[model samples]
Target: MKSSIVAITLMALFTKSFDPQPELINKGNSWNKNPVIAHRGAWKKNNLPENSIASLKEAIRLGCYGSEFDVHMTLDSVLVINHDADFYGLHIAQVTYKELLTKKHPNGENIPTLEEYLKEGIKQKKMKLILEIKPSKNDPERDQKLTDRAVAMVKKLKAKEWVDYISFSYDVLKRILVLDPKANVAYLNGDASLEKLKADGFYGADYHYSVYQKGEWFAKAKELNLTINAWTVNSAEDMKWLLKNKVEFITTNEPELAFETIRAVQSGN
Candidate 1:
């Protein structure tokens, strides 16, 4: 009996040691002052598998304002997180989640479902989730279904406040607006006019970094009271320029560099 008691105590101690403690996240409008969004969850520099849960957790640990990730639906309507249409040679749109379960990311994590991803995301309340809803290329019907399911799941999870939906498809973004009139949506296509965005009630513009370079779109977006976010900005020069221009958010593969740049700018160096 004494040996069994000691074994139980050891097991309890081991579990306690391994349990992850939630970090104290900065709250409310904290991201307003120049946020650094980790594109694909701080995966690039860390050599971690992109779009995996590990990547997401790492972003939160790094205190990124947001972690950007892509979501696609399986044949069984399970919303899975991945950047590409295919996973381990199996097409995500054509395969069931059960089939996907047989494969794993390079880091040994199974393709995470959107539900699973969001649950993980919510654990770190300070980090916003930049969810890119990838549209179906040839199937408009499937595209609509994907959008519908994504909206529904996010609503059910009560995670709307933490999520910012972005898409290259104007139609898909419009459908999201229809589903939740208050949903924060950003247009990914860099060509849209600020006036058009303002009139259509879009939350902001998440365009390519270069799109803001040549035009007065940055000034125009600010004029319209629209939030501006630029994507995949990796270079120190680009990062510094964006910071100087006062872009609201910078999505980058090089989050460490981005952070350093922001600190330098803030310190007036």
Candidate 2:
């Protein structure tokens, strides 16, 4: 009995030692200087292919605050990183992993599994993995299962600290909170009222720049102590506006441009 007890204790120790997120979550304040998120893995500028591991690495190399990517599950339940509903005419949700292996990304990399992507992410602890869980078209069941599997994968990898979950589906976002209340989740639909988001206990809001401009959501977010993240804000003018508004994170296709704009703003140029 003593031997069995010792083995169990060792297993628990191993699990705790592997937890990737050893530090507390950053709640998006002035201290968060690294606010530039590489949308779709910094794919636009250097001709690097979107959703490829190469682009992810480039994002890391550039020292962006986060690298954003999308994930969808296969018919066999394997999770793959990609941005589109279909890959080269192959529907990701309808096919098997083996069939996917036959295809390659624009960079010639095989469609990466979630494990593969996270493994790469684990190599560098500086950047957050902005994981966007894509909703399955007409497949609500699969979407829920995918959220569960995604949370499981992150826990198994001990990457809770370095990952943030974002989704357009309210159901999926809610499921993420139910699965892990401590998770940093953002609603992507850009429609959830600030009062509702605060009431629901979400981490923040990730919406289009227009959403922020059209209403007082940014003010409400500040009033409610929620982080504000804007998506695809590639224009220098828009970036300037968000920066002035103190938006916590800016997801952009042009990380390079964003960096330049931020530097200029800081210098009062």
Q: After superposition, how far is residue 25 of candidate 2 from its true place, in Å?
A: 3.1
Judge candidate 1 against the unseen true structure and give its global Cα lDDT, from 0 to 1: 0.83
TM-score for each of the candidates: 0.87, 0.88
Residues 86-158, candidate 2, lDDT per residue (tens digit)? 8778998889999989898777899889999998987776788999999976778989999999999999998
After superposition, candidate 2 runs with Cα above 4 Å error:
1-32
- The local distance difference test score of model 2 is 0.84
Instruction: Evaluate all candidate structures by whole-model CA lDDT and list the values in order.
Output: 0.83, 0.84
Query: Taking the tens digit of each residue's C-alpha lDDT, what string does model 1 give over 137-186?
Result: 78889999999999999999988878889999988999999999988788
